[model samples]
Each structure stands twice: as structure tokens, then as C-alpha cells.
Target: MDLTIHQNCPSCGAPIELHEADRLIRCPYCEVKNFMVSRGVLRFVLPDRAPENIERSEMFYAPYLRFKGNIYYCKGKHQKYKVVDTTQQGMNARALPPSLGLRPQAMPVSLVTEEIQGTFLRQTVKAKTLLERAALLTVIDSEKIKAPFYHRAYIGESLSCIYLPLYIKDEILYDAVTNKPLASGGSAENMRKSGSGYHPTWTPHFLATLCPQCGDALTGEHDSLILSCHNCHSSWAEQQGKFHSIDWSCVVSAETSMYYLPFWKIRVRSTAFGLETFADFLRITNQPLVIQEKHTEMDLVFWVPSFKLRPSTFLRMGKNITLRQAKIPDGEPKMVQRMHPVTLQRKEAIQSLKSILAGAALNKKKLLPLLPDLSFQPMSTELIYLPFSDKGHDFVQEQTGISLAKSVLHFGRKL
Candidate 1:
């Protein structure tokens, strides 16, 4: 469902196009990068194909919400992953198609602009509802997996609203893109009352990538969700339409990191479960080592990779980091020249907590019973960048002894 979004560079006023998921806007003309600050859900429109002489007032837009991401679930002892990339009608009116089909994929789209002459139909369907439907549409085959217990999580999701243009001609509703008359949906009147005219409030806006602590420009790749400031030696992530200072750290290692891979260090206060401390985790997971005083004294925190990777690597990487969190010495947070882009947002990382816990547990049958009641009350979170040696085909972190294939990283970017 990813599509190109046309934008004008704030620096040079030169037009630049970026994928819908991209947050960083790099100008080819000016050669300067700026972060795209969006206050609400990103909105894009399908180019219309109404008759050239048609008046602008005859056109109106229908809304569709697209959900793209990965869903991970634990069934008994088996961990499975499902890919979901689907679109649903964003409006309540049944007259319109339930989906735009492959229109969005086949045609070019433009970011909604205030200058548009047509009206935008209000999006009546909540994103949560659409996402639920998408989950159901892409659910893993229940017949194949024989687990009585199941817990699922959605991560790395990209949510956006796309508008389909329609036109009214000769008192008949017509698809603006194809100029085809409506098959069954009644006259244009039904479409008009779908909602109050859609407003520009949902349009994505841009903000300068300036460090709030120090007015220096922040830096990150187009898809990087977390941006770093070299001047302040700190990191910031977009939260609720604004920049929030992220508590981050870097572990010093003998091997210079080719890419300081970022990982989310999250501590959760679980209800109806004894998962609050490292000792509890050790006991529940049936660790080979006998529980000791030091283990009990250590707080339990999960380390989740802040980037996309293969399902196997994702679980292994998170487990390896969590197992060694206590030993991974605290080091100063430094922004390296070649830091890996954080593709996964913090909330998305949190969604995988329960799944990771399930993967780490020794006995799935015992752990599955406690999952429904395991409420993750996040106490605190931090971004920890670990030094990873650049192996020819993969990345190896000596401290954690975790290796990630370069192909996994490359394929994840496309995801």
C-alpha cells in the first residue's frame, strides 16, 4: 500500500517526492533534509480522470484507510508471523465500494492540498475499527496451528487515509478515475450526506528537524522514526505530533560499531503476573542457572530491536539483549556518523512485549495461561544503541553475541 507522496522542500521550495511512510524529507535540489511533522493521519488522493471540461464543483472524494504491517502471535509454544496490508472503506456509506481495490497501487497519488476544488467525504470509520478488520482479513490459518491458546500483537504498522475521487454527472454518480457510472449506488445525493465536508485538518504538515535542546539541525534517514542531534548528543522521537526528548545510551565496546543499532529498553509493571524483576523472569522461564540474589536484585526490562527484521532474528535479537541487559555496561550516548535508522516506533515496540515474553518462556503451556491477565504497564523506557561489528553478510554484536544477516536488514526496509 506504500505510494509516493509529492511534497515541496521547505528549504529550497523545490518539489520532492517521498514514500508515504517516510518522515524525513530530503531535497534533491537543495541537498538539505527536513523532517515531515504530521499533526494527524497522513492523507493522500488518487488522481482523478473526470472529463476535462467538467467543473470542479461536480467532484467529491471518498475516503479509504489502509493498514500495512506485521502481526505476531504465540500459539502454544509456536511463534508465528502474518503480514497484513489491506484497505477498508473509511466512510460509513455502503454505496461506495468496500475498498478501492488495486486503484491506489496502480495510480499515482498526491498529498491533499487546500487548493483542491472538490469536497472530501468525511471519514466516518475509525482507524481502530479498520485495523481490526484488516487483522481479521489477514489472520493466520487457525486449522494449521493446533494451539488452544493464542495471543497476538501488531507491530511496524503504517496507517494512512487515502481519498478516492468520484464525480456527479447527469445526476448519476460516477467513478472519477474511470468515468464509469455507478453500478448500484443511487444518485449523487447519497454520497453528499455521508458526513460533514472533509476538512484539511488531517493533512500532514512539516516541521524543521531542529534539536529542541540545542537549535542544531537533527539528522536521520527518510524512514527513520528516531532522529539524533549531533550537537546535543541526544536523540528525539516523534510523539503526539511533537518532538519528545528520548533518554538514550550507548554501550562502549572494544569493536567499533559500524552501525550503532538502536534497541528499546522497556520496563513494565505487570498486573496478575510476577514479571517485574529479573529474578521473576528467570524463575518463570525456567532458566538453566539457579536463581541467585543478584538476579532478584535486577529489574526486569525487555530489549526490543527498534528496526524490522526476520521473525526469527527479531525474537533472537530481543532475547539476547534482554538476557544481557544487566551486563551491558551503561555508556555515554553518542550519535555516530553511520547510525542505523530506527524504523519501528516506540509504541510498535511495546506491542511486541508480550510476544517476546512468550518466546522467552521455557514452558509455553504454563505461560499461555498467564498472558491474558499480563497487562503491560510501562514504567519507563530508554533507547540503547549497542555497537555491532559489520560482518560481510551480517551484523554481529560481540557483547550480546547476536548476529543479524544483512539481507534481513535490507528486506526489512521494504517491509
Candidate 2:
């Protein structure tokens, strides 16, 4: 994983050095912050600014992907099936401590977003691999949704590469950022050992706030995934060092003043499982609903919120929507107010959709036997804006008149 990528500072015309481990770098001459981005997997390191009092201390950035999303687990088969549930989960992206018990918890640290300065430990595990390991720990069988599950599971409204500061002093392990002791003796000694060599590097890319296509300054709420370029009349989703064209449509509402909320409307075709229709779902789940011959093969649609909200609330929203009928109306919205930032991207949404379908299918009938295989093919994806009325501390859905508490919205000023 030793990569020597040479780049120049976007702010100043100065050669920027970059090592494989560095995600954010600063220019020594111009003092500009630059971020390292790539289409492939990327790793980031946090700056260590520990106190100078510790006589013997070693600082290094340990990599971890902060995960936030739902976790589903089930065991047994047919009549013996039991213990099926889906709960929100968060996982630390680090190896479990050895028998010495030097477990370090990642806590909040003031990160230098403007300029990061530190030697990063080469990310021995890729984010994708770490996500897989997390899914395995959760006993999830599918792989396609694992990455998305972890990506969406990030505690905050966004996914981040976290590097914790590990300090060793007198054979005692301490969290340098918090100055809290973690473990002593052999565990501390083991953690102090380092094998990854840091090479001299610099940050290459500048954080762009303008539209890459039209060169117009992008306008949107902070951390929003959807950016609009009025010059080109296009909406783009910023993902993985590139701008992707996203299908955006707003619901037509009669209300004069309304805010358009974004939701990932995903249609998926399930194969390798017999639960393909409403009747099949009812039969498999043993629901009391009467089976009708007209209910044949049907595609599963998921309306996942793009903004951050409580896990329970989000799950409820996903279950309340009806597929196929939730299409976004054609034409531009008169005035769409962007509320919270979109935390989930399209790829992650697809992965999450797969997991959601699998979880629903598996947990539907504990008494039913397990399927031989489970797979999903995405039929269509769109970023649909649903109109909502901001009513003081709550939001009322324009179409359905359903009301939601303001606390459910993770971002934006209190209404």
C-alpha cells in the first residue's frame, strides 16, 4: 500500500507530496489544506495534538470507519426459527484487542479540517473489507449490502475515516486525545509497536464548492449531497471524487409555501426467493390478509429518506410508503427548501435496499425454511423530493397529511 502520488496545491502552484496513508495534507509554503481523493478506496488520518506533559509518549493514527445503520440478525430454520430482529448498529473499524485487553474507544476530537498534520498508520484493512468484517460480526449473509449498511450506519449524518490517537507512557496505554488510560503493561507494549512506515507526502486536491460542469458556484446546505448549478440547470450528487447526474423531481403540491424533502426511491427485483408478490409476502409471513389471485409478481420499492433521522423513525417511513405510486411528479418545483443534508449516496442506497429486502424476507416467517439464495437487482433509482409543510416544531406531509416531529430531522435550524 505504499503509493507515491505527486500533486500540486490548487490554491498555490507548489509541488505537493502525498503518501499512501495521508488523506488530508497541508502545503508548507502556502499553508493551504488539501484533501486526497480517488475513485478507488481512500483512507484518512487525524492530526494528533497531545499535551507535552507526558514524558514518554508515542502517537499514531489508527484507522476506523465510523458506521451507522440497521443491523438484522436471525438464527435457526423452519419451526425452530427464533430471535429475529433489526436494530441500529455502530461499529468501530479496528481489530479487537488481544488478551491484554487494550480496548480503545473512539471519542470526539477536534479535528483540524483546515490543515491536518500527522503520520498515519497505513490502513491495513480497506473500508470495504472492514465493512465485510462488520457484517460477518453481525452474522449478515449477503455481501452487496454490507458496505452500504456500514456506510449508512455512521452515527452522524455522514461517513468518516476516523484516526484515534494512541499514546503509550511507562507501559501504559492512554487515549492521547482524551488523556484517559486504556490499558497497561503487555497490551500497551504491544500497541506501541509499529510496522507501517510513513512516507513524506502532501495533499493534492482542493475542496471544490463550485459546479464542475458549469463552473458556477454550487448552492446547497452544508454537507448536502445534491448540488444545483443554475447556469446549467442541472442537479449533481457529489460522490467519491466525482459529480454524478442524479434524477431530481419535486412533488407538485397545492400549498404556496412548501419545502421539498429528498428520498431515495428505489425499485428492486428480487430473485432466488419466492416472496415476489404481495400474496407471497402475506403467505410467507402468515399474515391474516386474504390472498388474492390478482396479486402476482411485483417489484419491491423502498422510499428511504436522504436526510438523517432517528433509526426508528426512518424504519417507520420506509414501511409506510407504497411502491410504484410514489413516483415524483414531472417539472421543476417552484421553491424547494433544502432542509438537512443528504447523508446516504446512491450506491450506499442500493446496498441498503438489498439488506432491507433480505432482512424483511428472512424475518417475515421464522417458521418458514430459509431460501437457498437471496439476491436483488435494482430496476430504477431516483432522488425524489416530497413536499412538506413546516408547522412550527413539526412537519406535515403535504400529500398524506402525516405529521413528523422536528427532532427527527438531524440537521437544520429548529423550526
Candidate 3:
């Protein structure tokens, strides 16, 4: 008979049953929610069909850290040269047995549906060392270009994590899920013996939004970095595991019934490449954008979507819009009707904005040589809910009458 192990709640010391797939659990006695942290490292296996004849086979999971982000390099002084490139790579810090003959490949794994079962190989390599090594490799492989001054390389907006499953049987190494032999001719004695116990080495913190003042549940969009407490009529932005109060406003539309979208209203003082104002940006780029003197001091506001969107689409939308202060009516709308379960954070939105600006500057052939230090001063980060009309699979912006496909907005049937 198969035996199941029951673990006690960390908060209340009450016995609780947990499945392998359970990432989060709540204590019934103490009403405390706990997040499952992996001990050592956890990697996901690729979804593939098992071989028909393989009735019983040994399986194991190997660790590989996947890194994704923008790589930037800068060199020189007066006429500086800079390059920013996006990259995704998988790196294996550990030395694999010669018989395995498997090369690490970057691929997405569905953590929710996929079942990861097998012995997890201990990570012998440190995460920091691996990142530095990968960064160095990227720099070395890049096309050689001459710079007049100092050289500096760095990565921005980066995320890294490990993923797994390699199978072995009869001196042949196979992919755990696919059952495809990766290599043959290795002695079975060369591989490490499977251990009987499985334990997590690291813990993942659960993302939860609660009103700081009233201790009530807060609501926000899936991609929102800001959340609002309806009970206390307060709004806050979450950053670095803390929440700060912020000012918010919504555009009042004529439509009686409407849904609001969240956006990050950002303002920044950029000092780079001899550019200071919006007019300067337009003049340098020679774009046909017109700016009046009265609106010159107006902060550069970026209306970034608080929901998930395709990268290309997100950039396009951000580039087309101009920032201006919205005129509010007598009484503002209640926060309860506008808050959503926000998933994206302020840091991520800022990263996207920076990427967009960099790309635009490069394309315009203006300010491409000088690396600017963009100091973003959060004048006020608001959760502005713009009115949108639901048209089945598309949402039409009430003000601009622009119809956006639901898929592009990542607003599936859940909306």
C-alpha cells in the first residue's frame, strides 16, 4: 500500500495534508495561509508522450537556471556608444556525465498542470556565479565594436529560475516526459543513485494585497502594481514588499455602464544627450509632434496597462499616447468599483517604459550615442481606470474609440 505523509502547519502546528502539486495551503485552525517554498531547487519537465513499450522506467530531474532580460553595454565619454539587446538563455552550472550528452535549451514549462515527479539533483553551482558567467559569455559572443572611453556591461529587468526532468534506464539517458533517449553507452554506475526523500530547499512568497490601514482585502488587476482599499477609500502602490499611499484619479466618461482599466502614471526628469523636455525630445528626433509652451512643464506621464499585453502591442500603445493632467469632476468615483486583482508591479512597468524609450531613441537616430540617466520621480502613481466598452472579443476605448482585440489585451473569458 502506498503511504502518504502529513505535515504540520508552520503557523499553528496543526497536522495538514499536502499533495505534491499544492503550492499554497491555509491552516483551518489558525486561518493562516502559507506558501510552499522549494528546498534546494525545482525544475519543470517538458510535456511529451512516453514511449509505448516503457512500462516501468527510472526517472530523475536535473537543474538548469533560465535567465531572461535585456543586456546593455556602454563605452566611451563625450560621444558614448551604447547597445541594448534582449536575451533568454538556459545555463547548467553542474557538469553532466559524458553519457548524458544533453545540452540545455530554453523552453517554457506550465507549472500549474505539469506534474514533476523524480529525484531532484542537488545544485552544486551558486545562482550569482551562474549569472555572472552567463553575462560574460553574452558579452564575449557579441559583435566587437570600438568605444572611445570606459566599458561597462549590465543586465536590466531580469528574471531567473531553474527547471527540470531527465530520465535514465538501461545505461541510456532519456527525457523524463518525452521518453526520447538523449544519449546512450554510459555505464549505469556512473549516475548518482536516487534518494528516497524529496524536500524543498527554497520558499516562494505569496503575493497578497491587503489594506494597510483597515486590514481589509484589497483588489487590483492581474498586471497592476497598485492596489486600492475600498473600505478605507485609500490607494497604495506595492514595491519591494511594502505598500505606500499614492494619489489616484479616473477619467469621467459619459457612458453610464463601463469597466475601468488600470495604468501607471509615471513622471520623470531625464538628463541625457542634452535633452530635457518634451519639446526637446521632439526637436531632437525631428518628429512632427507639436507641443505648446503652456504644457511644456507638464510631467511626462506613461499610461502603462495594469494588465498583461503582448510586448509589441504594449510598446506601440505607449509610444502613441501623450501625458496630460486629467480634469476631475466634483466627486471622484469610489475605489471599490475600480480596483482589480493586479499581477504586474511598478518595477516591471518602468522596465518596459525604459525599453520603449531606448528603442525609440535608437530608431530615431537621435540621442543614440549618449547614455542618459533617467531619474523617475514618482509624482503620483495612480490606478486610472479608463472606460472601455465590451464588444464580445474586443474592448473599445470610450474616449479614443480604439477597438483592441481581447487576446492582445490578455483579457480572456475571465473578463
Ranked candidates (lDDT, high to low): 1, 2, 3
**Compared with the true structure, what per-residue lDDT tens digits does model 2 show for residues 1-415?**
1223444566786877654334445677896554344433233343344678644224655555543344433333211111111111122323322111112122223222324433344445545554455456544454333322211222222233445666666766666655666766464444445434343232223456566777876556534556666677667764556667677666757776776677787776665547565555455545455565654544455777776454455544654443223333454633355434465567666655433433344353342234324555777887777877989998877776666787667432210
Global lDDT of model 2 = 0.49
lDDT of each: 0.79, 0.49, 0.48
lDDT of 3 by residue, 176-283 (tens): 555666666263224436232244434333444567789887654332445577788777764444667776766656666666665666665565554556665555
Q: Per-residue lDDT tens digits of candidate 1, residues 1-415?
A: 5686677677887878788668888899988877777767788898888898888875788889988888787666666777777888887765678888887777778878776776778778899898778656435455576665467788887888888888776677888888888755454566665534546676666777889999999988889888889998988888767888989988766655467788999988774566778888877777687878988888778999999876767887887788777768786877667678999878888989888888787887788767777878788999888888888998888576678888888888877
| Residue 351, model 3, lDDT | 55
Those runs of model 1 whose alpha carbons end farther than 4 Å from true positions after fitting are 92-94, 138-140, 144-150, 193-198
Question: What stretches of model 2 exceed 4 Å from their correct place?
Answer: 1-66, 74-161, 164-194, 197-204, 271-300, 323-335, 338-340, 354-363, 366-372, 411-415
Tell how far residue 14 is off in model 1, in angstroms: 2.5
Candidate with the greatest TM-score versus the true structure: 1
lDDT of 3: 0.48
- Estimate candidate 1's RMSD in Å: 2.3
What is every candidate's alpha-carbon RMSD to the true fold? 2.3, 9.2, 8.7
